[model samples]
Target: MKTLLVDDHEIVRRGLKQLLLEAFPQAVFGEASRVPQARELIMQQEWQLVLLDINLPGGSGLDLLVEVRLLRPQAAVLMLSSYPEEEFAVRAFKLGAAGYLTKSSVADEMLAAVNKVLTGGKYVSVALAEKLAIALGNPQQQALHETLSSRELEVLRLVATGKTIKEIAAGFSLSEKTIATYRMRIAVKLGLSTNVELARYALQHHLVD
Candidate 1:
């Protein structure tokens, strides 16, 4: 199998590559530090699996996953992110990722996750599996953040982190008006009227670090 590893950190890329090489000695591997580089590599070669990070330079790994699904329908993508699994795993799965693993996971678990995806299976940590099951069993108990669309959730996270609309617009390369519109929509969806309320809600729900 061929694999592509995408991450901004060189040390992480190197470590993951070495781990993958040890786990699947015959598997050909490639690496990229940003979405554009990864896109170039994808256009030039076919890969059986892609190990992606949620945070990437220039673009999000979620966006890359969408593009990969469109460009290479058969390639399985396993997301590797520092974000909490409960916060992003379901979204990633909905976006066509085959598996989701957090950065804090052990090396053995990482190897097992890669192997599971390679063999046409999905992977989630045991704790995450239990949490997912519980959430499925009780719809009313679901987190409010889960009700938000991916983009709205991203906006909420940024707001919770104390980013102003202008700063967020600059960070996302969007217009301030556009970000303000999103903020209003998010407030409506979450029953919040001000940034203070939004920040409080986010903190109460542990939505931000």
Candidate 2:
């Protein structure tokens, strides 16, 4: 089996590689710390599975997921993030991820998720399953954050965590002006006027820490 791991943290990649190696001893692994490096490896090789970090330094992993789908329709792509399932699982599915798992998940769960995807099945965790059930049962009761685009939601989360526009821009490798635009859009969508309002709303809805 051929697999690729894309994450900014070298320790995370090393740790996950160890876990995966335990499960599939013969698996050949590739590591990338940024989107560009991942993209280059994707273009050059065919992978059976790609474990993608949703938040990347130079680009959003969601963006890379779309590209991966186009580049290798048969490749199984699983989204891995530190964020909650409510924050990104639905969007990851919409972007063609075979599965979405939080970094806190147990190694066994991770292996099962990877195996499910390898066999051409979708993997949704118990937590995400419950959220999906709730959303389906109460479609009209969706939170305001649900209405925001993925990028807008990301910016809002950063704002909620007390990150300034400059800090958010640096984290996303985007311009401060672009982040400001996203912040404005988030404000408009959430019916909130100030950054404080945004932060309060996110906290109230449990969108961020």
Candidate 3:
């Protein structure tokens, strides 16, 4: 099997490579540290699966996932992130990721998750599974933030975390005007008229830590 590991951190990529080598000795693995590098590698190779980090230096992993789905329809993508499962797991799945696993996940769990995805199965941590089940069982139990677009949700999250529009724009490498637009859209979607209200809603829903 061929696998690609995409992460910006050298230590993380190295550690994950070592773990995969131990678990699947016969698998061929490739690593990339940025979206452009990953994109180039993807075009040059046919990978069976991709282990992706949600945060990259120059681009969003979610954007990469969309491109990957189009370029390699047969390749399974497992999203690995430091963010909490409830924050982005559902959105990742909806965007065609095969699974979502947080960086805090145990080694055994991570191995099992990769194995499951290689076999065309989805994997989520036990705790996240329960959360998903409950959310599915009762639509009303779903977090309101889940209704926001990926961009809006991101803006809401940063806003709740006390980032100003300028900071958010710098963080995302976007224009201040674009960030402001996203903030406006988020407010409109959630029926919030002010950043304070948005922050309060995010806190109430646990969107911000």
Candidate with top lDDT is 2
Model 1 collision count: 0
Ranking by TM-score: 1, 2, 3
Per-candidate TM-scores read 0.87, 0.86, 0.83
Off by over 4 Å in 3: 157-177, 193-209
Which pairs in model 1 have colliding backbones? none
All models: lDDT?
A: 0.86, 0.89, 0.87
Error of 3 at 94 (Å): 0.8
Point to the candidate with the largest TM-score.
Answer: 1
Worst 10 residues of 3 by lDDT: 200-209
Query: Each candidate's root-mean-square deviation in Å?
Result: 2.2, 2.5, 2.7
Per-residue lDDT for 30-139 in model 2, tens only? 99999889999999999999999976867678888999999989899999988788877888898899999999999999999999999999999988898899999989
lDDT tens digits by residue: candidate 3, 62-159:
88898899999999999999878987899999999999998889899999998899889999788988998998899997766788887777778788
Residue 6 Cα positional deviation in candidate 2, in Å, after optimal superposition: 1.0
